[model samples]
Target: MLRVENLVRRFGGITATDNLSLDVARGELHAIIGPNGAGKTTLISQLTGQLLPNSGAIRFAGREITTMPSYKRSALGLARSFQITSLLTDFTALDNVALAVQAHDGHSFYFWGSARNEKHLREAARSALARVGLGHRADVVVSELSHGEQRELELAVALATKPQLLLLDEPMAGLGITESARMVKLLQELRQEVTIVLVEHDMDAVFALADRITVLVYGRVIASGAPSAIRQNEEVRRAYLGDQHAVTDHA
Candidate 1:
């Protein structure tokens, strides 16, 4: 569903994404894992069009979107959920998602006075919230929700667009064990519905959820294959996993 070819991006003398290339198949969950400074976020930024590659190409479902603006990408069924929570803390969870629906489908947040009050937008928002297990918390102010709920709300916001491929940047970044487990289960279910490209540090989550894992080092792919193969890869263990052998223990 997504293909990146010879992708390169640099900052002054530093190369962030060096001839990076990878592909995500339809209906499969592909995970990108690497240590800090490995360029995972840079790759995602370029894929989402937030940061254009210095050179190379990105194609989604057969359409070239390398330089397409992020909003245009969204229109083409690409959506991203960031590592950090991107929610309107003052609004109810339902309101936040409803605005996404309005922006994606209605093309304007103000097409109707308040998105949550528009029956169509409201119903869609409700469905997204329910999918992310946030239905009962819909009316709660984002600021008042727990950190875990906020993270779930972010997923709901992304789902509101009905994306074909969901790019999640560390959805479990701040969660505790219990919350993380809940997220893992939620993703297991979500993967059945949408193609997912995940960038996360949580090895247990990555190994548990990934259909394929790509290891990156200094902006290049060090290894890419099934979880078992990645675990036995000497270089992957040497560079990133580094006794981070939770890799072998996850499944």
Candidate 2:
């Protein structure tokens, strides 16, 4: 569903992505794992068109979107959730998702006043919230939601776009043990329906959820294969995993 070819991004003399390339199959959950400064986020930024690659190409569903604007890429069914929660704290969870639905419909924020009252938009928003297990909190203000709920709200906002491929950046970043487990379950269920490219530091989550794993070090892929193969890869172990044998660290 997604292909990145020779993707490179640099900052002055520092190369964030060094000739990185990978492919994500349809309906598969592919995880990108690496240590800090490995350029996982940069790769994601380029893929979503937030940051254009210095050179190389990115294609989604077979069409080149290397130069497509971020909004345009989103319109073409690429949706992402940030590592940091980006939510309208003043808005109700339902309102936040409804606005996403409004944007997906090609309407600008100016039309939100009327769009908020639109039954279809509200219904779509409700559906998205329900999909992320946030239906009960639909009317609650985002600020009042727990950290995990806020993270789930971000996913709801992304899902409102009805994306064919979901670019999830550390959905398990700031959760408690229980919360992380809940999110893992949610993603396990979600992977059944949509293609996902997960960039995460949580190794347990990555190994548990990823159908395929790509290990990146200094912005280049060291290994790419099933979780078991990634675990046994000497290069991956030397570059990232190190002496960390246990992958399941919920705490």
lDDT of each: 0.92, 0.92
Supply the TM-score for candidate 2: 0.96
| RMSD of every prediction | 1.4, 2.2
TM-score of each: 0.96, 0.96
Per-residue accuracy of model 1 over 1-251 as CA lDDT, tens digit each: 99999999999999999999999999999999999999999999999999999999999999999999999999899999998888899989999999999999845654545785689999999999999899999999999999999999999999999899999999999899999999999999999999999999998899899999999999999999989889889999999887767345455
Which tens-of-lDDT digit does each residue in 118-164 have in candidate 2? 99999999999999999999999999999999999999999999999
Pairs in clash, predicted candidate 2:
none
